[model samples]
Target chain A: MPGKALVITSGKGGVGKTTTTANLGLGLALRGHKVALVDADTGLRNLDVVMGLENRIVYDLVDVIEGNCRLAQALIRDKRTRNLVLLPTAQSKEKDAVKPEQMKELVKQLKDEFDYILIDSPAGIEHGFRNAVAGADEAIIVTTPEVAAVRDADRIIGLLEASGLYDPSLIINRVRPDMVRRGDMMDIDDIIEILAIPLLGVVPDDEGIIISTNRGEPVVLNGRCRSGEAFNNIVRRLEGEEVPFLDMRGDGLLEKLKRLVGLR
Target chain B: MWEFLSRLFGRENEASKVAAKERLRLVLVHDRTTVSPCLLETLKEELLDVISKYMEIDQAGFEVNIEQGDDSMALVANIPIKEMKRALSRTKN
Candidate 1:
């Protein structure tokens, strides 16, 4: 059976699109499925740095498309796992350097060999976004709880629908449970009501994310943070497993007691 | 006591999230409508001009809005008519 191509995108930048792509791609590969992450952001390539495979990138998407290198030479195998590979993008090329048809053909080839091809799209509704989504069979939108991010997610949903990509799921990132409890931030229901997309999972704003990113390790591999656990659950959901949402309130009596003793 | 308690609880004013939700609601409506205010304004004016030749419409009461629906959107306009104009006499050619 051929694998599915899913694009991870957000209309706004700095909303963790690359982070989610790296985590989800690795999460699926850890489950023994062959996965390939395609960085379609072209000039603004980032999946390499996020995945800690920057130094190993001998070729990129543009090289493969331009026939400068073969497809096998461009794919960088993960240092930790052989099942997952990354097809990095050329940082020096423009967004229009690669055509939509080329991307579609590339993803089609990857689908035959991998269980999942997660295309990490660039931020915006421009050519970069279009090329990234060209060969996608499904789409995952990453957004924060902020107004601008939510609004852009809504706009992306409309654009996706116009292009015949229907019912894209949402992943809300950088959620602050304490702020939500204090009514200082928007809650899950508020965002769901506004965006009206199926909720895949929510990741808390854990400091572990910053540490893991700096260390060039995905949070899912850490396996200690709440955000990592949340990502694991999302992976299960993608595999048709019904995992319950994590308890993010963080105000339970036990937690409060721990906080009192400075054990948190 | 109530005043002091309210102050202490920081409940004297509404939560800022309420305002965020309200603003997002309004903005999403405009975004989803997919029609610019300038375009809508021009359409409203042209519609009024076309309708005025046949009847006297209540210009102050005329309103145009985009009613969003599930899987569809409608351009709804409410133009109140005060009176119909009599047809002008025409000589046979």
Candidate 2:
């Protein structure tokens, strides 16, 4: 049976689209699903670096599309998870290197082999964004609690609906529960009200995410940190399992005192 | 003491969050509709011209805005007409 293809996109940059793709792909793979993470952000590819598979890339998505390499040849297996693979993007090529129809064909080819194909879209609503979502069955939009990110997410959701990918789920990344509790930052409810999409998961602002990214290990692999557990829950939700959202509020009296002092 | 301080700070934050939500609500309505400020101005001007031909409209009282709903947006126009010139023409004939 063909697999489900989902595109991870954010119209704004640096809202954790690539990170979400890397972690979600690994999370699904760990749950015994064959997953492939495609770096659709050509010329600005960083999914390879995030996945720690930067050194193993001999052929990229463009290469496969241009007929320079077979589709199977471009897929690099993860160092830890054999079920997970990455179809990297070309660092030297432009976004136009792959057309929408070509992307559709590539995704169709991969659908037969992998249980889930997750595409990491480039920022902006241009050719790159178009290519990223060309073949997606569904979409998962990542955004922060900031107004700018949520605004861009709204535009992306509109674009997705216009393109016939309606009802795209949302992942509110980098949520500061402490700030939300104090009404300083936008809470999950605020974001959902604006985006008007079903919630997938909410990842807390965790230092462990930065460390995990630097180490080329997705936080899901450790599954100890708050962000890691969030990713795990997202995976379960994606698999049609009903998992309650994690309580991201700060714990203990000391934390409350620090929040009171405006220390975060 | 901590509760008191937090409540004091919390009031300011609550006001800001309300402001933020209001701002975002208005902005997202425009964004989803792809209605730029310039576009809205043009639309209002064109609507005024078209409506003025049919009646003597109160230009100062005229308003055109996008109103967002739960699942849709509407281009609402509140054109306050001062008098119906077309009615006068019909009566004169």
Q: TM-score for every candidate vs. truth?
A: 0.84, 0.82
Please write out the lDDT profile of model 2 over residues A1-264, one tens digit for every residue: 899999999999999999999999999999999999999999999999999999999999999999998999999999988999999999999899899999999999999999999999999999999999999999999999888899999889888988899999999999988887777788888888767799999999889999999999999987657899899999999999999997766556986687578675
Query: Mind giving the per-residue lDDT tens digits that candidate 2 earns over B26-74?
Result: 7776675767789999999998877766798888989889877775788
lDDT of each: 0.91, 0.90
RMSD per candidate (Å) reads 5.8, 6.5
The reply for model 1, stretches above 4 Å from the true place, is A256-264, B1-7, B12-14, B36-93
- Residue-level error in angstroms, candidate 2, position A32: 0.5
Chain A only: give the TM-score of model 1.
0.96
